[model samples]
Target: MSRTFDDTRRWVRFGTDLMLRSVGGLDDDAFAASSALPGWSRAHVAAHVAANAEALSNLVHWAATGEPTPMYASPERRAADIEQGRALPSGELTAWLRRSADALEAGMTALGEERWSARVVTAQGRTVPATEIPWLRSREVCVHAVDLATGATLADLPPDFLTALCDDAVAKRATAPGPALTLRAPTAVWELPGDGEPAVVTGELHDIAAYLTGRPAAPLTVDGAPAPALGAWL
Candidate 1:
């Protein structure tokens, strides 16, 4: 089933709440521990999630006002902002995360129906309507919740979201020139873009999505062998 804008907005809120709940109890030492993402601490993941809300809110502003507000000033600045956010006190960081997410949602709610069709560019340079903003944020909070290396897992995601995420990840992967592959889940199968004979990967839907997005996933196999290495999703 396709998701309406309202559906995606609800998902943005739901995912953010879940992420907050997952991280609410972390202390300084817990925040300093390594996350599922290599070389990133739970602090880093929290900071990035907070920064992303602010960045994506820029797109909402641009759509509403017909101004050109890029998600970030530049790649270097984005990285630096995350670093700065990472150093914030845990209390301050969580507060920022909550505030930014609320502000983004308010801005989105204030946008007129017509304004939703206004074009904006993602950090990845893809030009899309403002309607995509909610989905973008949804992916960040939901996936990063798991990246926190907390008890949250992909299976905890809504069934619809898992499918959409898998499809989106596979389509994005297909955009670049790379090896061809096939992803098989119990209920669905996706063909990754590239040349040559596709390496067939088989797993549960959520695990396949996790594998595609570079998250820690349950065991999966490629052509009866261990899953091959993959580059970062974004």
Candidate 2:
């Protein structure tokens, strides 16, 4: 089923709520512990997610007011912000994340339909309509919640959200120079960068999404072989 704008909006809300719950449950020690990502702690993950919300909020404001607002001042500054966020006290970090997320939600909700059509630039330099803001945030919160290593997993995500995530991952790989692979999910089929005789990988939908998104994936096979190693999802 194709997701509507409203569906994406609800997904943002749901994903954010789940992330908050997972982050909130972490004690100071747990928050300092390493996360799923190598070399980054849970604090780093939370900080990046929080910083992302504020960055996306800049896009929403640009769309609403017709002002040119870039997602971040610069790549270096963005990285620095996340790095700095890691040092924040646990209480302050959580409050920063919650407050920024709330501000973004409010900004998006207040935007008119016409404003939603305004074009904005992503941090990656891609130009897209403001309508993409929710989906962008949805992917961030949902995926990062699992990255927090607070017991949230791909299983907690909605099927539609997983499908959308897979669709996005596959689409991204298709446009770039990557290995040729065919992903067969229970409900859908996706062809990654390849011409012919691609490795056919079969798995449950969430597993496929996890593998594509650089998360821990369940058992999957590539042409009856072990799962192929994938580059970072970007």
Candidate 3:
């Protein structure tokens, strides 16, 4: 089923709420602790998420005003912003996260129905409608909450969100060179890369989502063999 803007908005709220809860109790030292994502601390993940909300709000503004506002001045600037913000005290970082999320939602709500259809470019250079912004935010908040490593897990995500994530992950992996693989979850089956004799990977929906998104794959199993290493997927 196609997702409506309302559906995406609800998911975005849920995901962001979860993210806030995940990091709410972190102290400054805890924020500096390594996150599940390799080489990134909890602070880094939190900074990236906050900056992402602002970057996406820029798209909403572009759509609303018909101005060409890029998400960042440049990739270097984007990295620099994250580095600058990542060292903030835990309380300030948390406040920044909340404010950025609220600002993005307000920017979206301010758009007229017609404005929602206006084309906008993502940081990745893909052109999409303004309606896509919520889905993009949903993906970031939900997945990164787990990366925060503050007791959140893939299973904590909403089922429908996990399904949507699997679909998106498969689509992104379609053009990458990899062995054809079938991801089997209780709720759905996805064919990855769509060619050749497919290797079967079995897991719960959350496990598959984690594995496909470059997270740990310990919970997933290949059909009577070791799971093949997947190549880089963003």
Candidate 4:
């Protein structure tokens, strides 16, 4: 079933709330402690979460005002902002993030659930209806929350979220060829058809996510393929 804006809002809220409560209680030093996502402290990952929200908010304004929106004025600027912001002291950084999240959610909800049908330009330069906003928002919040690894395992994700993520990954991976990758779940498997010579892997959904999003996983093969590259696109 296609998820509605309300559905999206519900899932997004659930995911972000879970993440904040799960990790928000960490002390200042603990906030800087390591978790998933190589080389990025928890603070770093949190910064990206908030920064992206604000960036998307700006796009919402562009959509409402008829201003042209580009994915990134330039990738470099986007990267620079994250790199700098991620280093702020834990207390200040976390507060900034909470502020960003509140503002973003308030702004989005202000548009009214019915308003998502209005056209908005995407970061990718595609013009899609506002209905897509929640999907995009869900992706960033849910996946990145996992990236943060806040002591929460993939098992904590709701069923619909996991299924939706894996299914969407399958469709998006169809045309792209790279390293052969396989996603094995406790109950089922998702096979990605890599370039001409398909590569394969087998692991649980969380394992699949871990590998795709630059986290470590079991001995999944990558023979003549860089299957993990596809994760970057999402």
Candidate 5:
């Protein structure tokens, strides 16, 4: 099934809600604990997700007002913001997360059909229309919720979103140099890098998405062999 912007928005809302729930009621010690993401504390992941919401909101503002707003002044500045936010008191960090998400949601709701076509640039330096914003935000919240390590897993994500994520991951790998592999999911098959007698990998849709995105893929098998290391994505 094709996904519409409305579907993207719903997923964003759902994902953010899940993220909030996962991190809720954390104490400073809990926030300081290491997250599933290597070398990143729970606080670091929370801060990054919060800052991401605001950065994306800036893009929505640019779309609605025709101002040339970039997601960040520079890569260094983005890193600095996340680092500073990570040091916030536990309460403040939680507040920032909620506030930024609320602001982004408001910005998205304010955008009309015409504004949806407004051009914007992603932090990765890709130029895309405003319609891409929801997908970007959805990816962030859903995936990072697992990074929080508060018991959320990729399986907790919406099925349709997982399917879309798998497709996107395959498309991204197709453009980069990588070992040729065919991914088999319950509902779809995608050949990564090229179409050939590639190594066949099989797993649940979300597990495949996780593996392709550089997350754990213990459940995935490559041609009945050990899983191959994936190239960098994002």
Candidate 6:
């Protein structure tokens, strides 16, 4: 099925809710349980997503108000801010995430399709129409949510979302080297490792997403550079 950006946003909201639901059943200790990713607790991941939503909401507000805002106007300042907030209690983190999502939702809903096309600048100095914020926001939450071990794989995400992100990650390897990711597919022999047996990335698109994001060993082969790239992406 085809999807407009708004459609992507709706699905993103649903996916975030899914991740949140998984965490809801867990206690404080479990919330802080170590997931597959090193240096991040489940609560830390949750707080990061929630805090990001709040940050994105602020940009949306700036756009609505006709004030100056860049994609991440304070790119350098953001890391410190999120790190500080991620240390908050689990209860507070959950509340903050929900609040951030609600605030962004209200702002985006009020703007509707009409303003999505309106031009706005991001902290990185790129100017894009406001309509794409949800795409950005979705990328942050949906992907990071998996890191929390909430049990939802990227396979659970919408198909288009999965493919686009994977392809994007692959293509990015050429120019950005965002992470060393190996894509194991049916037709060709794809191996990122220069050495070692090829571990193929197995399963559906979402599984590829989760495995790529550092969750579990994708039923794929790993030999060389891609293995290190995994850590970079994580």
Expressed as tens digits, the lDDT of each residue in 1-234 for candidate 2 is 366788789899999999999988666788899999999999999999999999999999999999999999999999999989988989989999999999999999899989999999999999999999999999999999989888988888999999989888888877766678888988988888765467788998888999899888864666467667888788
Better candidate number, 1 or 4, judged by TM-score: 1
Please give the CA lDDT of all the candidate structures: 0.87, 0.89, 0.89, 0.69, 0.89, 0.64
- Which residue pairs come into collision in candidate 5? none
Off by over 4 Å in 3: 194-196, 219-222
| TM-score head-to-head 1 vs 3, winner | 3
* lDDT of candidate 5 at residue 177, scale 0 to 100: 78
Candidate 3 per-residue lDDT, tens place, 35-152, comes to: 9989999999999999999999999999999999999889999999899889999999999999999999898888899999999999889999988999999999999999999998
lDDT of 3: 0.89
TM-scores of the models, in the given order? Answer: 0.94, 0.96, 0.96, 0.79, 0.96, 0.75
Q: What is the C-alpha RMSD of each candidate to the true structure, in Å?
A: 1.7, 1.5, 1.4, 3.8, 1.5, 4.6
lDDT, candidate 2, equals: 0.89
List, residue by residue over 1-234, the lDDT tens digit for candidate 6: 133686667766876787677667666788778864688888777766876777677678766877765434465667766676667777777777788788888888887556667787655566777876877777777677667776866666766676656654554344433433356544222334334443444455665655555556545434322333354442
What TM-score would candidate 5 get against the native?
0.96
Which has the better TM-score: candidate 1, or candidate 5? 5
Worst 10 residues of 4 by lDDT: 219-228
Instruction: List, residue by residue over 130-216, the lDDT tens digit for candidate 5.
Output: 999999999999999999999999998998898888878878888887788878888888877654457788888887888889998
Candidate 2, which segments miss by more than 4 Å at Cα? none
Estimate, for each residue in 35-110, the C-alpha lDDT of model 4 and write its tens digit.
5877888877888877777877776665555565554667788888788777787777778778877887887878
